[model samples]
Target: MGTYETAATLDFVVDAVPGLSSTTLGWILVILAAAFEFLGVIGLKKYSEHKTLFNGFIYLLGFGGAFAWLYFSFEYLQVSVAYAVWIGIGTAGAVIINMLFFGESKSVGRIASVLLIVIGVVGLKFVS
Candidate 1:
């Protein structure tokens, strides 16, 4: 395991599972973060020549959402599961968010990637 994995493992037993309200709010935060981040990336491409106020707001919202999720994910959920779930969940969420916001195609190519990511998350138990 890497340093992050190690530290996350160390934290797993120490942190408490957040309450229902917090967990619900945490997931919303993560999803919002992922959505805004995607928007920010797309905005970056679209507004490359000239920065726009909306683009800046997207970046700020993205960071804010991610910050909130990271705080709860690490402090409340602990590292190992939180880190793994963060990537997997965020990645999956990103795919859907892209579809929603940009009308991005979720063809077999993209679907496969999401499934593989899901498999990887499931496989983490074997390693840990």
Candidate 2:
């Protein structure tokens, strides 16, 4: 779909869900979107390694859910602010999850950088 069509659909969805434009709901949706974004990245990795139809389907579901939630969140939050926060959460969450679960690096500098991303995300939310 074109950008206009996609935007219209997002509007419709937001309108259909009453109270979704509330600050609490918007934040919840953004957080959920971030979680799904992490899941989507994990699915991408699995798909790359295994190349299975199931993995690809999981990836699509994760990404689709992430975008849908993020779009709904924009009804209440500024798009630029919301997007940056969402991406920040996703990036940090992905790295942390990988470190804890996937046995990725646990270096101090890497941990500190993730902490900085979290701080940035919090700052953006506060300013917005």
Candidate 3:
């Protein structure tokens, strides 16, 4: 479908869901994108450890889907805001996931740093 048609369909979908607006849907997409980013990061780590088709598939699917969702979000949000939020969520998620599953450092400073990123995202949301 063309961009216009896709956008119209997205609007319809958002309107069909109770209490879900375009902006809210956009934020949801941003979060979804970030989730996929976690998978991508994990896949990357795994691929580095072992050269396997499955890991390569995971890496491609995760990053590709993440970017697709992020693209959809831009339909309802400003590019700058959506990008910043996406990056913030992805960065924080990757760090936490690494710490939790990959045996990365879970230092207080590291957690605090993630918290700072979260705070920045929230601040951007409030201002925009």
Question: Evaluated with TM-score, which candidate comes out highest?
Answer: 3
The best candidate in terms of lDDT? 3
Backbone N/Cα/C clashes per model:
0, 0, 0
Residue 93 in candidate 2 has what lDDT?
Answer: 87
Candidate 3 global TM-score: 0.90
TM-scores of the models, in the order given:
0.53, 0.82, 0.90
lDDT of 1 by residue, 1-128 (tens): 55643232223323454444444444444455455556555555445546788876665666566655565545444456556756676677668667766688979999899889888866763453
Instruction: Report RMSD for candidate 3.
Output: 2.7
Distance from true location, Cα of 123 in model 2, Å: 1.0
Residue pairs in clash, model 3: none
Q: Of the pair 1 and 2, which is ahead by lDDT?
A: 2
Q: Tens digit of lDDT per residue, candidate 3, span 1-128?
A: 55645542368778789989889998888899998988899999999999899999899899998998899888988989999999998999999999999999999999999999999999988887
State the lDDT of candidate 2 residue by residue for 1-128, as single tens digits: 54653342345545678766566667888999998998898888789889999999888888999998999888768899999999999999889888987789999999999999999999998987
lDDT of predicted model 1: 0.59
Candidate 2, residue 27: lDDT? 84
